[model samples]
Structures are given as C-alpha cells and as structure tokens.
Target: MNEDLTHLTREELIAEVVKLRKGIRAHRDSTMHELCWHHPQLWNLLPEKTIPEIAVPAWPQFIRGCLRYRESLDTQLPDAPRVKKEFNDPDSPSNI
Candidate 1:
C-alpha cells in the first residue's frame, strides 16, 4: 500500500473520504441483511420498524466507539491496521 497521502490534494482527500464512507454504509447494510436473514425472529420482534429505523440511529455512536478502540490499540502499536476495502461486494456468499 502506498502509505503517502501527501501527494493527494485536499479535494482529492475529501473525495476519498466520501468514497470510504459510502463503502462503509454499503458494508453495514449487507451485514444487517445477513443478520436479519439468519435471525428471522429478531426481525419479527421489530415488526413496526424498518431496518433503518432499528439500526441507523446507532451508527454514529458505533463508529465513534470503533474509532476509540482503534485509537487505543494504535497507542500501543503505532502500526495499526488501517481500514482497507473489504465487504463491499454485495453478491459475496459471506454477505448473504
């Protein structure tokens, strides 16, 4: 991986961030789908609410918690795992 972002202009960096956010949303959607598929009873328990209503509200806090956990790990080991592109393919069997 090219560990250099210095070459990217500010606009380019912002664009990359947007792209990453989209990928994250897609991954989250796929995971939620798999969860619902595996646990139909859980879906029934929340019959009145759509999936977004059930999950979207918690996304921000969940992301913050993840960042905090990663930051703590990074303090111990400077070379922490960066978010790489994974789980974006909706047709993957693991996603289903």
Candidate 2:
C-alpha cells in the first residue's frame, strides 16, 4: 500500500487528493438507512482490491446486535432528533 508518489507530478498528486476527498464526502453524506448497508464502492477507492471475508451473524443474533447498536446511539446522541417517518422498503416482502 506504500506506493512512492515522488514520480507523480504536482497536478497528479492534487488529482489523487481530490479523488480521495470525493470518496470521503460520499461516505460522510450517507443517510441512516444507507449506513446499514455494506459499502464496497467506498472500499474500491483504496489501492487494495482484495475483498476481506465478512462474517454474518444469524437472524436472531443480528437483531440483538442491531438493538444493542441502537441503544448505544441513544446513549451517545440522546439529543439527536428522532425521525417519525416510516421506512418503506419497496423490495421487502412485508411492503409487498
């Protein structure tokens, strides 16, 4: 991952910085629901192309994990505004 950048022109170095900033901005602007999904596009921005093996928890365990995460958010950002809008996932069977 430690590629020597000495060969790159000033313009090239600036272009790299610009590209990195754009990727960071995209991640920073993700919504609450969007944050729940995996972001391979963001990972692709890095020099490493290899995908790391991901371990998924079972449904019951995953739900418990989600609950704990939500609880942590409540503790961390207690003053954050709550959204009452229902999340309608168009592709979900329940929505159908």
Candidate 3:
C-alpha cells in the first residue's frame, strides 16, 4: 500500500486520505458494535465524543504500540474462542 501510495500525486493522496477517513467514519458504528461484543464494559466507558476527539488521533499510535508489544512477546496468540449457537433444535420454531 505504501508503494502504491508513492505513485499518487499530492492532490490524489489528499483525496485518497479524505476518502479513507470518510470510509472509516462510516464504518464506526459497526466497529463500535464489535468492540462492545468483545469488551462491553470498556465500550461503555468510551463516551461518544471521545471517538472523534481522542480515539481517532490516538488509534494509529495505540495500534503501533500493540504491534510492537506483540512482536516483543515472540509468541503467536491463540485464535479467539468461538461461541456455537443451536439454531435448529427439534423444539425450535424453525423445526416446528
């Protein structure tokens, strides 16, 4: 992506950045939903205004820090556990 970006003119890069920012903002709701699913309590602590005011600015740095920490650990993290749902039981409405 960086190599591709290098080919873009300054105006094109600015336009791409604007488009990417808008795309990120548009997906914010889904991102928040995923965050709530993983950590409901932490999600609740993040005020609505904090996203635009703080999270956006801090996100890149935070992610970089996380990546550096993960690299330092020198261990592969296990995959997240999956929850199975029984949607087709004999007594379920769909079976009925």
Candidate topping TM-score: 2
Q: TM-score: which is higher, 1 or 2?
A: 2
| Model 3 lDDT per residue over 1-96, tens place | 257778889998898778766655545544211432333334333224243333432888877976775564455434433334233454534221
Instruction: Enumerate residue pairs that collide in model 1.
Output: none
lDDT of each: 0.54, 0.77, 0.50
Tell me how candidate 3 scores on lDDT. 0.50
What is the TM-score of candidate 3? 0.30
Question: Model 3 Cα displacement at 74 (Å)?
Answer: 32
Which candidate number maximizes lDDT? 2
lDDT of 2 by residue, 1-96 (tens): 547477788998899889989999998887666757788887887776797799999999999998998888799889866654445656544321
Model 1 TM-score, 2 decimals: 0.31
- Quote the positional error of residue 52 for candidate 1 in Å: 32
Higher-scoring candidate on TM-score, 2 or 3: 2
The C-alpha stretches of model 3 lying farther than 4 A from their native spots are 30-96
